[model samples]
Target: MKILSLPALLFSLVSVSEAKKFQRCEVTTTMRKAGLDLYYGYSLENWICMAYYGSKFNSGAVSGSNRHGSQNYGIFQISSRWWCSDGKGKTANGCRIPCSKLMDDDLQDDILCAKRIVRDRKRRMNA
Candidate 1:
């Protein structure tokens, strides 16, 4: 057996093959644990609906490119244009994360970034 670099090991652990397709119940529980139950005044049901429509509960799902040639990622369909960086072009990167992170099974980062989006949208609407 050969020793693998730390980065290599981590990559192997988080490979695309490890991507998840969460069930509805799993999404509900995970969303609740992430405090998305009523985040930004949107009910958990609202978020669940969006996630289902956006990704069909597939963590590894990627959307067709937008007019900007940037794709949306993961269950939330977080956009590469304004939210996460896709490394193909410049982005506002409002989420301060790589687009890949949004496509992973783990969702804390996605939830946090989505919260930022909602907050920003709310602020703009209020303004």
Candidate 2:
């Protein structure tokens, strides 16, 4: 078998590393857009971990046994019933996620909502 050139192998490794780094950079940017920078006060890794556990960073991170069985809606599990009343379920209006209604994918809204929650928690702790 013919041996591969070192430069080619090095280039491939560098490309993969760059791709991963870009993904992480995107996560950090999204976190900042979500107001995490002002509220969480943690590293991008922490933000990513928390959001992943919460909704896997999907805009429509709904969870439940069945599609219609008491399903929790949105990235933060806001609940479809409540979200509907808030005009968040209407696609034509201003709801970020038309189909999934997850809100996590909408980085700006997700970050703002998360920031609010983080701030509230901090207040509680200080109190």
Candidate 3:
């Protein structure tokens, strides 16, 4: 097998590190378990971005402003007023709030949901 030149190998390593930097531990672990390496999936990256957009990945982060008029719920920063009943137990709470409630745990429903989204996107792109 031909060996990659030093510069090419270094570039590859850098790209991977940049990709993993923002990924949540939960997303990282799950994707690996599912047989997706950096070469195969951008699922981890997408989920990390979503988490930031949702609530900066703060498992305990809540949102409310004196001007905003309501408390957003949990890590996914779910807005309770609109999704209140739907988000009954989706808050960050537990030995790490990941596998329990859908919102609170970083690895909860979001990871699985992300996996589905990424997989679909990948399929569509390939098709």
Write down the TM-score of every candidate.
Answer: 0.82, 0.45, 0.37
- lDDT of candidate 1 at residue 23, scale 0 to 100: 97
CA RMSD per model (angstroms): 4.3, 10.9, 15.2
Summarize candidate 2's per-residue lDDT along 1-127 as a digit string, tens digits.
1356876777778722111112446767767665565354666566676656656555555566334433444444444442222343322212333324344334555454444444555441121
lDDT at residue 57 of model 2 (Cα atoms): 53
Point out where model 2 deviates above 4 Å: 1-24, 33-35, 38-40, 65-72, 75-104, 122-127
**How many clashes (backbone atoms < 3 Å, residues ≥3 apart in a chain or on different chains) does model 1 have?**
0
Candidate 1 lDDT (Cα, 0 to 1): 0.84
Candidate 3 off by > 4 Å: 1-23, 30-43, 65-68, 86-106, 109-127
TM-score of 3: 0.37
For residues 1-127, could you state the per-residue lDDT of candidate 1 as single tens digits? Answer: 3455877888879845346899999999989998987787889998999899989999888988888898889888888888899998879898799999888888888788888888895442121
lDDT of 3 by residue, 1-127 (tens): 2465877777778732111113467655754675444434455465455567766655555665324343454444444333232334443321232322434443444444333434454442131
lDDT of 2 at 89: 35
RMSD of 3: 15.2
Give the range where candidate 1 is weakest over 10 consecutive residues by summed lDDT. Answer: 118-127
